[model samples]
Target: MNLRRLKYFVKIVDIGSLTQAAEVLHIAQPALSQQVATLEGELDQQLLIRTKRGVTPTEAGKILYAHARAILRQCEQAQLAVVNAGQALNGQVSIGLAPGTAASSLTMPLLQTVREQLPEVLVYLHENSGSSLNDKVMHGQLDMAVLYDRAPTAGITSTMLLKEELYLIGAGDSPGHNVDLADVAQMNLFLPRDYSAVRKRVDEAFSLRRLSARIIGEIESISTLTAAVASGMGVTVLPESAARVLVSSTNAWMSRITSPTLNLPLSLNVSSRLPLSPSAQAVKNILLSLLSKPTIEDRELMLVG
Candidate 1:
């Protein structure tokens, strides 16, 4: 296999434009495209789909890119192993954090930890919902993710970070008390959409026990959901930290559900398609070390450390 052609193909995929890739490679545009075509012909598979905007990897291409990235990374590491024997490591890592998990618990602390420890690594941080983050990981767009999904999507692997008790958040002015799941099922509630990750878990929990909640409204936005709860529009379920993000210092109160206690689990997920770069592995190590402390909502994280 020609390592040079593999590098060129990877570069084009990275930049998403043959023209841009040619410019970066300092080669003629036609020559760049031809080299890519030759690579495709040799492999006997269509790797990239060209569009008006740019090029995207096909499923086969995504798989090839994943393996190619790992191979190329191993090559660089092999070189670094000899050249920079005792030097500080340097590389780039792209990571995604699910929104609910990022609330004062993981995002900033994780960033600070990386900056303080692995100063040479360039970290690209992306914050989105679990569904989106999982999608990005599968497509080889993100190196790893810290998210809240007990059961991750296909082509991804995960380890548990923490198991948190789910709570019924309500206005502080209202009666603040521990409500059993039976009672919780009777309250006026504003829940996330039916397809929501949390909602799916919540529904499964309820279904397992053959219990149901009086869901009054379906809220898509956390801010709106918190506001409605604070206004006494309805109650919503969330982990303590996430509920606090919506109304930490405000009049909202957090109380755990009982009689079939509900729990929300957070996880660290990585794609099976790609190998972890050294930079990403370093970040993962740091996170595993740090999760033992009170970084989460004063809860004990089920960590490797």
Candidate 2:
């Protein structure tokens, strides 16, 4: 397909008026109409429905519009890659980090790395729930995200970054140890809301054993949750990375949940349909490199592709 004709078609569909598209393209309306006609002829499909008010894409046109957008975006990225070749990448790349996992802790390191390596690239970090971040990534609102693998991956590509074993965090500072799932289930728990990916996993694991977790409250904030755990109000489940931080700072302890190992896989996700810009790809590479390295605090984390 002719890139120019596809561009004209997209603009017309966006504005819903060939006249306006011509005005924006600085071309005659007849020429713009001819371009669309030629595009429709080439594709052998009726792409639009024109009426007195405006034009709307036909079923085929809707499909074509989506593909055209992806194609155009890839073309733009290619142009940028060529232009910025052998030069430092400089652009804004937004990434989402789902809370309640080790992924959330990478915000500072990500910023520091970008500042040191890709100084010209500006990073925008979004810390949110996995489902929220997943939606943002699928919609192309974010360049990439680190989310739990439990989230739906229908419209995005997710590569497992690491697997973190869940730990039961509770009061008492006797070094960390193993805690059976049956025993841990009896404790009053404070976990994220049911909609959260971690919460769903916790619930599913309990359901499989025909036992229910005694959850006292839903806590999303780490500080509040840790405070509650430290005050002996209740226990909460967290990955080793987050549990380590809680135990180090608070009068609390973390025990690896066993008797049915529950591990949450953290994955790096990006849109499957849209291509990443050069700057975004560079930041993604940095994230992969940083997260892949082994650390003392997260020694048990199982790194994946």
Candidate No. with top TM-score: 1
TM-score of 1: 0.75
TM-scores for the candidates: 0.75, 0.73
Model 1 RMSD, rounded to 1 decimal: 4.8
Candidate 2 lDDT, 1-305, residue by residue in tens? 87898889889988999888899999999988888888889999999999999999999998888778777778877888898899989978999987766766777888999999999999998888887887777655688988777655787899998888898988864434888889878888999998787788899899998888999999999888878898887899888888888888987878888878898888999989898998998899999998987675546544432
Range of the 10 consecutive residues with the lowest summed lDDT in candidate 1: 296-305
- Give the Cα lDDT of each candidate: 0.77, 0.85
Q: Write the per-residue lDDT of candidate 1 for residues 215-252, one digit (tens) a residue.
A: 99998777778678878877888876687676674677
List where candidate 2 sits over 4 angstroms from the true fold.
1-79, 82-86, 173-176, 298-305
Clash totals, every prediction: 1, 0
